[model samples]
Target: MLVDIGTEEGNSWLGHIYNLQGFVQFRLGSTEDALSFFNKAAEAFRQMRRADDGPWLVVNYGNLAWLHHHLGDQAESEAYLSKVDALMKKYPSPSQDELHAETYAEKAWTLMKFSNDRELLADYFQRAIKMQPEMVEWNTSYFLWLVNTSEHRDDGLAANILEKMRVAQEQDPENFCLAACYLEQRGKKREDVKDEARELAVKVLRNPVSSYNGMRAILRVYSNYISIDEAIALAEEALELHPDERYLKRCAALCLKRKIRYFRDRHTNQSMIDRAVSLHEEVISLYPHFSLVKNIDLANIHAKSNNGMAKADQMYQDLLKMDLKPAEKQLLYNQYEKYLNSD
Candidate 1:
């Protein structure tokens, strides 16, 4: 459909479509296909000389650089990166930054979604938000990152973050930002936020935004406030609408795991656990970089099942050998220790 629309819309518009296709293909693990799409987009922009130095071209060049780097073609990667540098120099941003808000936000989101480097993730998000403070999505994401990366629980910090979220929500009441904010507050045991959070969850779920962030926010709300069955149902519904979204798949798998954990003794829950395992395996197969976290969850699920003890033990051993960050290593150790104690 995008290809068809792009064909009818001409080169400038086609460039954008190609860029979108490249991102989708890259997420789907078709790096070569992604490279082709990005290259075609770049060519389209170049042909339209007026747009060759536009912000869109920055995206094309940046994606090409990233794809090349991923493919281990450092020469090609650096060449494409040099193109971005040249473009930035030719068309300087009003803020005197090397990259535009769009580019920063793109990189920030990519890192937030795929990478575990919290410091880099926070820095990129801060850069993007500094430039585009009114962007509700970025604000919501930035808040989430702050909540997640805090080494210790700080009530004052949480309250400050919540106030900022309230300001953002006021600016964009219809956005998913409020849902995220309320959910975060509810998680912190703010009883006053529960009713409001539930209301926002219903509204967001009823009219879910068709974006990755939107889906994640809704899933987070359901996972916390609603029953496991409802969360799974919502995830399945969202998956039907966005069949290619691996994050939604992960959400559904996690929901199922929750159900399994909650009702492990029930015979019916066995099928749910099996299905959750299958989804986790599929996610790992699709994106091996996500394996460590997904595998940890999978190992925990297996540890609870009667027939999966050996496999769970093997997974734990393998995970312990992997080079993990201090926080990640601590989490794994704690979970494994808990499992041992449970036995």
Candidate 2:
């Protein structure tokens, strides 16, 4: 649909669509196709000849570099990386940071996926927002991160951030900022925001934005503010759209676990626990280095269900053997103790 629209309307619209397609293809592991789409996107940007638009091409070049590296073509990867450096130098952004908003957003997102450094992730997100304050997705992401990190540490700071997010939502009524803002309010247990948050969740889920980040933002709103069932449903819809998106799969699994936890009755439904466990297993199989937190959740579910106790014990032992940080180990022990104590 985006391609069809782009075909009818030539210009920066086409360039942006091609860039999105490239990212989607890259996520789907179609490296060669992604490279072709990125090349076309760059050509489109060059044809447009917008001074500021050249900086936008940095993401395409960076993605191409990463894709080439993954394909074991070190020379081609280096060439693309060099091209990105040249582009940054040739078309410097107004921030003079040597890195564009796209680069910062990409780094922030990658860190969120694979790294445990929330402070660094927050820094990158802040830089992206500073460079492109008008970008709704960046604002939403930064706000979410602020809320996550500061919810218990500093209520005053979190309130200030929420106010800023609320102001941003008011300025751009149609963007995803409203979703994030209302969701934050809901997290504070404010009854006034519940209806608005639900409305925004439905609105975003019905007509989500075109970017992967946009989809993830929408999913986050659903998972955090909306019902767990709704979150799982929205995740399933997203996975149907982007079948190879591991993030969506992970989100779905997390939502399923949340749903299970919502039920105080451990014997509510055996099938539900089974489905969540299966999803977790699938995630571990697909990404071996994935976070073990989900595995801990799975073990807890098993123990609560009074089924697969042996497997749960084995999982707990495996987690203990891994070299985890002191905090992480303490968290695992706490969760295990709770699981053991649960009726």
Candidate achieving the largest lDDT: 1
Q: What is the lDDT of residue 195 in candidate 2?
A: 65
lDDT agreement with native, every candidate: 0.69, 0.66
- List clashing residue pairs in candidate 1: none
Give the per-residue lDDT digits (tens) of candidate 1, residues 90-201: 7666575456765776677667556898788778878877876865666766665565565245342466677786676666665554456446555655444446555665
Query: What is the Cα-based TM-score of model 1?
Result: 0.60
Q: Give per-residue CA lDDT, model 2, range 1-343, as digits (tens).
A: 2332223222324565676777778889888888898888777767754543566678878777887888899999999899888988886766654567767776775565457898889888888888778766567656655555555542224456667877766655655534554455556554444466566656655543343233455555565556556667777776677566565567677777777776445445778778788888887766565567778887876765645788888888898898998989899889878877766
How high is the lDDT of residue 76 in model 1? Answer: 95
